[model samples]
Target: MSKKPFFLSIILFTIFLFLKGNLLAEETVKITLLYTNDIHGRMYPYENSIIAPETEKIGGFEYLSTLVHKEKQENPGRVILFDGGDIAQGTLYSNLTYGISMIDLMNKTGYDFSVIGNHDFDWGKEKLGHMISKAHFTFLSSNLVTKEQGEFIAGTRPYALKNIEDIRIGIIGLACTDTTVFGPESNISNYYIFSGEETLKFYIPILKEIHKADLIIVLSHLGYEEDVKLVSKVPGIDIIIGAHTHKVIEKPVLKDKTIIVQAGNYLAYLGKLEIEIDKSTKKIINHKGELITILNSQIEPDKEVKYILDKYREKYEAFGDTIIGETSTVLTKIPYKECTLGNLIADSIKITAGVDIGLINSGGLRDNIPVGPVTMEKIYRVYPFENMLISLDLSGKDIMEIIEQSFSGFHAILQVSGLKVKYDSSKPKNQRVIEIMVNNKPLDPKKIYRVATADFLALGGDGYNGFKKGKNLQNVMLIRDAIIKYFQEHSPVSGKIEGRLENSGKEK
Candidate 1:
């Protein structure tokens, strides 16, 4: 063979190898996004009473850690772990530590990022700031700003950029605007939660054009409906990891071009979102998403995380185990109508405050008290919010207005004691109250009445504006403490609905 021909053949082979390598590098890439939302400080696996029977054990930080490790091992560098906020402030473990346990656990579990949930501020801004500082991962929220300072809360960013396998992924964080209203009024009064749509409008374009993100993922604490509406309106978000609503979305919802995934509250489910991105266009060509139930039997608990939880358990076991009292009947939470639990709580507030009437929002009741030994842990679970009892003086007319406001929204019905309310839901918005009786007598619009309620309502939580207008406002005691006191005085308590709220219209 001629030497020149041999050299030419060698050169051609080398060029072919180089071009093939480049082409291979430009092929489609697969990335996996693992997310959990609204964990609510369920550090230990327990029965999912809302969804499953008492025999079924599901969700816990230890089991979630096992899932996280398995996912990381399977996907390696291609997997990203995130939490959609409200991780703190639910169970006894969280309440004891003020969410320090959750932060420490998430750090150990290797979370990449998280959005700010409204409940994260339940303990107040200082506490939330401390947790943010302690977190190993980044906290992102573009819309939560301080009203007094006119700046973003310290230590949180609008968005984050991560380069995964040569693709730049921008993760934007949008906190729920309802945070200002739903959270502890005193805690968030200095903050302004901007609309999610408005925040996205300002940030999405910046992420795409300026940051040059190949993919945009929003870690949102906004509810499912809000997330859907946001994606529909904004149009640039590629994926949304949602929280706050606690809806178990078994599959990803696709709206326009955006993919929305939410793992239900309390670590009951873990969402896995797999996306195939075309290298040329940098757009998602194919995607698959599903929620994996965190059943304790199927997945082993992570020993390391379990050890930390055990330490916390040892510390708080005394208070958690202390029997508060006993209940003769199951005190259930009825959100739409009056229930035994609501009546009992309302009565407790009334008796404790020595007020003529007591009112509590249906939404404030978090759990039910079983007809057995009532422990402090159970009470904490039932009333987890840090709301205090407030005594206010309001005219009978104001009382009627508050009742009408509560009945305005089907789910906003007020739980009451010392009053009987008959409402026709068929009636128009402001005219729903048919008749209101105080102590079996017709309401006197001109007379002043003493009312007791949670401070949350006194501050106009859940859109109860009438409560904010009361005269001679007095903060009594913590609602939880008052309930505990009531339990002490009335052991073997019986909670029964006594026709306090009468809905005359067709049942919804």
Candidate 2:
């Protein structure tokens, strides 16, 4: 062969290899994950301290819909939308529709997948199935399964595989871990729910080996801390988007090379994550995530979604718009502490049941009752759950146990009425309640007392297991109705943080 020909061929081959290498390096695919959690049917205009620190109202579902649609339009086929759940029960509209309206909105907004939150099962398992049936997107839960064969529950799958461009994305959805405990207990026991770490450990390998997923995303309804703990246990997760704690994770948490992000609750923000994947390595080499504040002022509402909302507003306006009563001052919830709103609601439940003591879970009180017209809508927002009121007859010892659980801090302290409880939280668990006075007298261990609370607590929700000891449990009315009735009977009512609960341990 001629020397010129051999040298020319070598130069051409080097050029060809260089071109191929550059092409492989530039062949990265860009993927955007749009997510929202704990929207809680808060589709209406409301003031949020998160997005706007000022008095301005933030969030309208139409605005969220617009922002989501805009991303889809701008990105074309590279976008996926997921909600961390809690779409079922929050606002009057969502509750009235059995969450079908929210499903309709999600369908229109182009959600790809979502997991079921604990509150989603609030209506009942059957109702959750109905809501799932209505959704245009898939619901995934690796943990919740029928006791038989350990199969994923009906209407939900363990994981979903999507091929976007050259990358195969595998998403494992983990439902709310507290589903059983935060339940209308009778409705949630058939299926077995597992821990996030266990479930993720089982599925991560399947996704990586069998499916050859280029990236793994775990959409979790287990709160932020649990998500971090799960990441610590499960080695292969690329990202975890979580809910249930209603955390405003302003910055994405990177642990063990995995990213975790949660948008604040109540439609305050839409979560957006952008990732660049290397085709050759099939890895997310770079990623950026942010919560887009849904400022109603910035974007035009989606007309179709807005029309649906308007229709509901007009139809239900008469239902919630009627002036139920008035409040002389604002009644906001303060978790694990004595708050005016909790006191007011507890008082209402106590008086309505004609019981000696009233107790309520602080989580049951979602929003604050502002000073002015106390409309049914406001009450609905505050007492979002349809928890029925129940009266129980229990010995003073059982009452003391319940009081101790409140101070133990496993959950928010139970709000109380008609009793003055003093807890030394610094003391050992189950030994916190140092003193209790009922009706200006000390609690009698032998004396049976009448107690009123939402059936949720009576059924052992939020870990208040002491309610199990009570006898003579009788159903009162829907909790919201009791609150409304209280307002009606007392129209110009007011609430203040009266030291009904004294943490003597904290005084020092």
Best by lDDT: 1
lDDT of 2: 0.87
| Prediction 2 TM-score vs. true | 0.93
* lDDT score of residue 293 within candidate 1: 85
lDDT of 2 by residue, 78-131 (tens): 999989988868888888888888898888888999998888888887788898
What's the lDDT for residue 207 in model 1?
A: 87
Candidate 1 C-alpha lDDT tens digits along 1-508: 5799899999999999999988875698888999999888888887866666778899888998899899889878989999999888778888888899999999989999999888888888788889999999999999988888899878999999998886899999988787424666336767787888899889888988999999999999888889989876887889999998888889899888889889888888888999998888899999998988888888888999999999999999898999989999999988888899999999999999999999998877877888899999888888888888999999998999999988787345889999999999888998989999999999999999999999888888877888888989898999999999999999989987799999998766
Model 1 clash tally, residue pairs: 0
**C-alpha lDDT of residue 348 in model 2:** 96
